[model samples]
Target chain A: MATPVLTVKGLTKNFGKLCAVNQINLQVNQGEVFGMLGPNGSGKTTTLGMLMGVVNPTAGEFSWFGQPPTHHIRKKIGAVLEHPIFYPYLSGQKNLELNATIKQTDFNNIAKVLDIVELTARRNDAYKTYSLGMKQRLAIASALLNDPTVLILDEPTNGLDPMGIAEIRTIIKRIAADGKTIILASHLLDEVQKVCTHFAILRKGNLVHSGPVDDVGKGEEIVEVIAFHDDLPAHLNQFQGTKEVKKDGQFYLVKMNNGFHSAELNRFLFEKGIVVSHLATQKKSLEKQFLEILAENNTH
Target chain B: MLHLLKIDLKKLTSYRTFWVVCGLYFITLGFTTASGMEFLKWLANKSVEFGATININRIPLYHFPDIWQNVIFVSGFFKLILAFMVVISVTNEFTYRTIRQNIIDGMSRTEFLLSKMLTNVLLSLLSCAMLLIIILITGFIYSPEIIWSEIFTDAGFMFAYFLEMFSFLSYTLMLGLLIQRSGLTIVVLCLSHMLEAIIKANIDDVTPGLIPFFPMESITNLVEMPFARYAFQEIQDYVSLTSVAIALGWLVIFNYISYLKLKKSDL
Candidate 1:
């Protein structure tokens, strides 16, 4: 049973002459890690801002949990948009307490969230003294103060080192495993690919593509093969499953139809008397699909 | 409402700038108002080149029916300190981007505006209470005779003082909302005061009646100068209803504009 956690209809925002977000309609379902993927200025932040009520939409409306959106509605949604916002003079624990106050939640939850973000040791230190990773974790802790059912994080791992990124990703995965509906927005397709069950791509304020992460770049499998023969492309094209074969310097790039395996292509080329020096199957990544979506929209 | 105020209290209590500004306001207001009689005695002891010596001690500066205006008039100058603090506190939300976060965390725009307004009111009430204590002690010590019936006389100035403080702080609040930067908001506040003064000076010769209606002018009029009575000069010895109404009117206008600014903008 996929209950709708959030539903946005024809949401739009315009800053003077610039259309930052335009006619965006989206639905986030329960117990799913939904990723909103877009490059900088593609309106991911703007859209999140509108959903959070910090940005007033020029048109349209959105609802939460099948009810109209309100400030009270937001109490159920924990969010960290753009940067980590807090009183720089306040300690990490005190900052989370402030969030708890606004959410009308228990102050006892502060300790739990701090422990989850692993900032328990330095919870008494002022926010201004915390490093970038610590500040980001404190923001995550603040967002989790209410144990919100819907967590919206924009660029949660932004500007963090590899270790910091892993820590946040681990926390997010743990939270999602608890059956919380999480909306993760990032420009990093790898992050989305690793954590998201469903994803949407936005380009120039328009939602270019949206579907399950598994369906990205469907209907095609790409495998790279290097053969010494100059007629490698011709030989690879003769395979029944081969959709197209293009030459890239010393390698032949083979696009295979659905259900076609690199093993089948290798056997076909081997039987055709063409021994391949190098052969590798390319995994269709969200990065490739994102770029293809952007490129596809660019041509239109 | 209490939750919103509690959130602001949590943010401000741990803020160093808030404490520093508050300390400055108390020290300056205390040093200036609490030393009133000593400063007057020191002025009276000075010798005069003219025939007669100047003595302000004999003027009954803290007498009943006069102490209210005297203390409030002097204390009113330090409203600028409270106004400065208000501007910084309001502008700090923008600088820290906490205002946006507060709303994102589930505060309505009206709640955010009301929270700041409630803080201003709290500060004003506290200031008035402190002044009342000081006035009572100083009045008892300096007054020649304690008249039981007259102690509450002219105490309307306390309400006037509160209105004055709240109105000025509300003005700064509106400016802080208009100009989201602390330094820039303070600069504009001071410059606007100077501009109003310049305009008042120039327009006094033509239309003095309209002067009392100006935002700052009306707030300043709330506590008329009580020193003129020491020179045996007649002063407006009581709080005027007109001035109070004007101050309250400006207060409402400032807050309404601030609320509109908050609602209309994308924080």
Candidate 2:
């Protein structure tokens, strides 16, 4: 059994009359890349803020490692919220030294983290003089200094170019490979699909969908089959496993019912003596599934 | 607490504005105290040359017992410069959002506030040390003789000056926490100072004894105007325990309110 790293129950946050985060419960386990997927104003940052102990929750509570949340507990969890926050007038090295001071970690770790972020060459430059991508990298280096068991990053690649985003994702993947639990919040579906082992989606402060990334579009199967015989499309409609079939030119798009597999379909067609010219199966894209989830739970 | 102080010093030592403001305060306080007598003698000479027949040199401004009060009272004006430094430092935490970062990095809100308070204590102690050195130098150079017993007789005024500096910095710290914008905080500080003076003046007209209870007035009363003795007029020659207690009470009140503000706010 996997050990639970973080458990949040009935977590809610309301700014005056506007509820920023509704009653939401979530649990993340050890060595899992948990992605918090949401659009703008969906309270992703607010939830992370509360977990970091910077924002007060309106209702409910959370714990780290099955213990109550406290500042001391936070030392075991590293986090970056919204944007990179550091003294602009101080050098990247100096800022990390200050963060190290606050965390009571060894100053020797600063050099190692900076080297991991590939910022060792420019560590002495003032923070304000660095580019946005460099600033984000420095934040990651600071987060890594504590050697935290769980690293939380909100929008780790929010405003970066394509190359910058790739660089951050590579670093995240490298860290996650070390058996550390990571909680990453981002609106990019592609990012979550690529890096996260599990994900939860939020819409307008409400949790709409959550589960393992592998479980997405798992129940049903869709197959595209083409045959030289024109009657193949007609035969597909009568198959017990077939839910719906649409013809496009010479190919028949078969939507299989729940629990149906492409092998069963091929077997059924072979028994019918229908030779197919082409056969392919496609799992639903996460982008389509995500949009469908949001569309299904569009109560707000 | 020492660790918190170290963290704050690291944040401050690399910032140019912090050094600039501290340097400005050091020079202002050092120059004003060191050259005060010469400036007065120059003015006395100009008046003599102008046929005004004034003999300002006869006044013993740097006398051993009186020098403590004289030096401390003059240093009060420069304390506001230090107050501005406190304001800028505290407000920069907000402007840069480092306060939020600090809290996220395993620091409690109380720890964060305590770190800033520690900085205040450090600044106050430094100011006092500079004052002690300058006052001793000035007293030994100009006094007729160094009476070891009398040299520190008026040193209670130095304690009062410390209370004055510390409590005043606490007041500015509260202001910085309340108003996160440095420029706006300074503006509010100045406006409130004027407003407090006006209120104190009006309150003195009806209840003269109650004026010392106000926050700013209480701090100011800790170091009462000692220059009145220069004109041979009556003055409170030493620190009063009642005034010290009042200032101490206000200091506690200011720090408590600041703590509440930091605790309740969503940094």
Candidate 3:
């Protein structure tokens, strides 16, 4: 694994008496796209704000590249908490230039970042004239101006249309591919699933799960075997590695305990006089894993 | 700090409303100067018909000079208008939620506060310069006999006026930061300006020397008074300087408290 670019330990934030963020621990590795998934007011924004140093933490500490919130380390971080608020009367290029001034970044990089967000053509237009997606893109451009090592985004695709979402996702993926750490906070499960390699599921300000995306749901890979079964075929038992068998309507569901070859299973069943109707592998989605986590928490 | 100042100046100049406000200031100043000049001319003619030996040269001294005095008057009024503009500049970031973004982008709370102060100071200085130029032109046109020395002396007082205006600007900026509402800030500023005016009008009579201590009043005194007033204009000069100091003292206190409040408050 790459070095941890961002480490958030025991992060907590309280708004008045309400605990907006409970003890949440997370980390973003260098060159990894980490996703923070939670519902509205679920402390995603609060957590991001704390990490960005805009919102003070009630408790806990976060470090960037092993350095705490110091001037040198903070310069390496760029963030977009919510909407991209700019001087509405100023053009997009001008807004980015102001951000550059604040960040002490090169003003010439404005066009490059604009082009990265596919907003090069709209650079001269006033910010108020941009569409919702375009505005979000401009915000992303502002964040990228410093070529920051860690880009923290809160709902980067929140209000974007389908096409805009796809575009932003592509841009973010490209940025991550360039070896920069990207931390995205979003409620869109599919967006998290598609874009994030590492995932942190936050619930009520607490981190429910944190690990690689593949390891979120850690059970045996279940392969659904659907066939027109009037009765359980003797050939089904001929399959050697099948762990458990269950009936779903007219189909038989087979859970694989180990690496069971679907082709071998099908061939073995066919040779034993069983007619196969359908067969496919099933993988649990991040949403399903998230809901299961929530269900388990509710039960406890 | 210089970079922050540059960004502020850029943002200030980018606002169309600023240009509109500046235009309004010039129109108001021009009209007030023309009207005041005409009224002085009429007053001079009446004094001559009455055989009171009214001298045109004395008219520039005893009566208000057409250019310098009018510039002072107009700029005083313009300060009230600029108060609203300054409030909008500071509070709009909060109202629009832009400060949050700025902070997240690595701008410290102190830097943000400093940026607004820098912008306010720049605007105040710009207004002061405009007032000076307008008065010089007004004097050159209508009150040619007006003592250039008096105008030059008063011009030096603009630095003091700038400081006073900056104190009020700082106070207003702090209010905007605290309330985070442009409308409320404007209302408070307007009420405060009115209260200061009333206090200034009654200062010599009631307080005996307290009027010059008020923030806006100190700026007015600095602009409207003769240079010799500092040494011989009763105790009012000493009181006025004290007022300017008090205003500046409040500015420091307000800014310090505001810095703490802003540092603690969530953007």
Candidate 4:
């Protein structure tokens, strides 16, 4: 297996009497669009903070590319913690210049970063004059000044409007398409589900569930079928690769095992003389799996 | 280190408030010093109206050797305004949360501290340069036939004045780190000055020797009452080494405390 981009082992953080982040273990792979899913007050930001050296970890340790996290490694990783921070009095271009200086990035990257963030026209404008969305874009531009291999953003769209959120999402997807490793921490499940290739659900400083999003409900396929005949449930159970059939009012939810698809089920039903009037395939989304993860945590 | 200083200075210079305050301070120093002879001319004539021979030409205040001490003393007060500038400079990093951001961008804790110290040193140097300009221009206007060697007479006071300004600014930088808010930091700075004075006064009355050892008293003694030397009062013939040592010591302490605060706290 390839070496993980990040290896977090038994990480923990505490603020006096409050244990803000408990023992958490995680491994992020290179070029993975990893989403740290959590609700408000969860340990998502704290975990990211510990990884970035902002907040001191109370226990355990984490490394980048199999090496301990250090200033050198940090230069290769770009991050935005909490809010988009910049000197308000400085122009957008000057702000990136400062970031470039700190990161020891070449002065040439300034123009390229501004171009990527699409703030070239407003490069000379003071940061205070930019809207929230513009400020966020400039922040992304600053992060890109180092041309980092890994990008970490906490709540990138926390306060954006719908259009602004979409704009940011588009930019993120574009960046992800370039195959850069991304670690996004957000409370918005919809945003995470839409953009993330993998996710880890965090609750009360604990990782309840984590894995590839594709494996959330396994490879099982579910089909909503409404048949002219009344005994569709029995027919579905009798079909090959049908794990179980759940009844939901007039429709039946048929759970298919691996190596099966909705077409195969439809073909089986047709051969069994059960003329299905309506059949619709359903794909399990991260939202459904995330809710289940949270529900599981709450019940415990 | 140079690159870091360059970056920090760029950030500071880009801010409008920085240039405004610094410009106002520089101009205020130049204007006041340039108008010094005018003020003396008025005072001399006023004294003459009372039939007193308080001759401006006879007095050695504006002449060589003494002008250095006199200008340094007057320009030393500029540190108070400059302290507010320093307070704003440091507090801005906290207010905008850029100090932590700068670290996140890749600067080490030591780099950040060094940058601020460098800026303070630069401010003191710039103030000294301004003081030099005012003194040179006025010195030539008042006494053009002086020896070139005498131009820097009592120059030790200028150096002492630089230490005094550096020490005070560091004191305010310490407060900036401690409070991290402009208004509150200034409030605490002013209150501490008043409080130190009050405490020193009571302590001075109760015990004479201890008063000179007070924090503010030690700093204030560095230049040794410039006005009295102009009046030919029995003052110390030169800048006191004890006060210089004490001021430099405070300078170190102030920066040490600031470093500790910056290091210990989560940026």
- Against the native chain B, what TM-score does each candidate's chain B reach? 0.94, 0.96, 0.74, 0.93
Candidate 3 chain B lowest-lDDT run of ten: B230-239
DockQ of each: 0.86, 0.82, 0.52, 0.64
User: Candidate 3: deviation at residue B39, Å?
Assistant: 3.1
Best by lDDT: 2
Off by over 4 Å in 1: A227-230, A258-260, A275-279, B48-55, B205-207
In model 1, residue pairs whose N, Cα or C atoms come closer than 3 Å (at least 3 residues apart or on different chains), thus clashing, are: none
**Regions of model 2 farther than 4 Å from truth:** A1-3, A225-235, A246-253, A266-278, B49-52, B202-209
Residue-by-residue lDDT tens digits, candidate 2, A28-143: 99999999988899999999999998898999999899998999988778899999999998999999999998899999999999999999999999999999999999999999
Write the candidate numbers in order of decreasing lDDT. Answer: 2, 1, 4, 3
Cα lDDT listed for each candidate = 0.89, 0.90, 0.75, 0.85
TM-score against native, each model: 0.96, 0.95, 0.85, 0.92
Identify the candidate with maximal TM-score. 1
- Name the fnat for model 2: 0.86
Q: What is candidate 4's lDDT per residue for B174-247, written digit by digit as tens?
A: 99999999999988887876898888777776788877666677777888666786665777747888888887
Please give the TM-score of chain B in predicted model 1.
0.94
Error of 2 at A239 (Å): 2.8
Better of 2 and 4 by TM-score: 2
Which CAPRI quality tier does the interface of model 2 achieve? high
